[model samples]
Target: MTPTAASERTHLVFDRALVRRRLARAAWLGAEPFLLERAAEDMADRLAAVKRRFETAVDLGTPTDAVARALAGHAAVGHLMRAAPLAAGAPDVVADEEALPFAPGTLDLVVSALSLQMANDLPGVLAQVRRTLRPDGLFLAALLGGSSLTELRQAFAIAESETTGGISPRVAPFADVRDLGALLQRAGFALPVTDVDRVVVRYSSPFTLFSDLRRMGAANALAERRRVPLRRATLLRAAEVYAERFADPDGKVRATFEIVFLSGWAPHESQQKPLRPGSARMRLAEALGAKEVPLPPSGDERD
Candidate 1:
């Protein structure tokens, strides 16, 4: 599908305003930035592996300056700036992910660490990033993947089902690697690549996990999320369920975070392209040195 069509078809899964508010609150509360720091380091390492240098780059909507700091003064990067979602972050540009404020072909690189997963129209945001890049410009990003917080989701679902006799959306949904890779292709990126990094964190209890999630600005911001706070009984039950199911032998509970990394480049003539169908010079059997066998004819063919 075309970019515009894809954007129009995207579901409004997240409450963007809520997400912004939570991010701001997390910043004010001095949220723990370990995840962003880890993502920034990983992205920096990946960029370092590439031979080319980028003259201009943007850190796109990261909650903090972790990515900018990791890449600043690097031999492969120059003139790095941040596009923050809120004004409090003191960003070079105040921009929304869905609508970037850049002219087409203006940037050499764009890196987003632990951002873009909460965007309501992720495809639209990716299309805008692709448009902002010059030919052969690179885009690299990491976002929480579908498997993140699976234990919490399971515990909450079980608790609600047992006590309340119903379940509400407690955790936000995240896209898987394959879907994100397809989005890169749909956004007109060349040589799109995607992979997952699973991070397992052990917490003292489920309550501790909740605290960390809030501090990370990752509390459920789904548009359809439950409005009322979970009942105390339900919360306690969930904690118990979590400990029973996901706890280690040492009595700590484990939380899984799946981080999905995506990298792609703007279309360029210098980049490699797939050969056209029927363009091969040799047969597969000949290349493999194997005999080719003919199959028996079908009944229709015999008739």
Candidate 2:
């Protein structure tokens, strides 16, 4: 039977097959995955301040298992498990970020490092996470933010537009800080908080950034991306544009990797509650030592 043409043309955003393939290749290169390690350290620090013990914890998407390692000897953590992409260093479990196989209310803590930005159905995945957590369970994660790879994205966009007469999704887009906070609430997480950690790394050249991204499994995997490989001229022009516009005084280019950290909790009755409207006994004037001015007369009130 002849193979269908449509199957060959169709591609999915953050294509799982392609991601696994690229990651497998990257594993052979022996490059350190620094981003994952750094984000894992941030999670460990944040967890230390929470002052709560989690008997059962899972570290998701941290391919290097850095979070798991950080949590292992900590007093607050009784056990630690790991889930990573199939091609990555052998995790305790292999799973997709979008689809987890945990039972509802089974977990006490869930943390992810330097992942989730690539999820096609992030809101849905978050909703699933909310359902998976036990009461008062914590969910902490750091994801690449909208500001990440701005230089690379811009250079690729301009180069593609100029050379190919159109621009495709050359670099993946990340979620905004506000949007992620709202998404947590929408996913039924209580007391959601979001903060940004902007990391500006100096690279000798754009190709160095590209090489790092390859090892980090942070490549463009957009569904609408052009099938044809980036033209040599386009790649060279992109490098030129990046160096010209984003280079520092020392000729090293600045590459920003903004990691947005999100923290939320499964709701419990003991958590803080907001006061209802008109519930305060003291007037605004009494509290602030200011007088309330009378409202201006409406047209109907005039004689």
Q: Tell me which residue pairs clash in candidate 1.
A: none
Model 2 agreement with the true structure over 1-303: per-residue lDDT tens digits: 111232334344666667666677777776456787788888888888988899988887666767887777887777888877877778887887777878899999999987688776787778878888999999999999999999898998888788878888888878899999999999999999999999999999999998899888777667677788879999998999999999999999999999999999999998997899999999988899999888898787765
Q: How do all models score by TM-score?
A: 0.93, 0.91
* Number of the top lDDT candidate: 1
State how far residue 189 of model 1 sits from its true place (Å): 0.5
Residue-wise C-alpha lDDT for candidate 1, range 21-100, written one tens digit per residue: 88888888788888999999999999999999999999999989999889978888989989978723878999877778
Q: Relative to the unseen true structure, what is the C-alpha lDDT of residue 279 in candidate 2, on a scale of 0 to 100?
A: 98
Question: Over 4 Å off in model 2, which ranges?
Answer: 1-12, 297-303
- Write down the RMSD of all candidates, one decimal each: 2.6, 4.8
Q: Which candidate is the best by TM-score?
A: 1
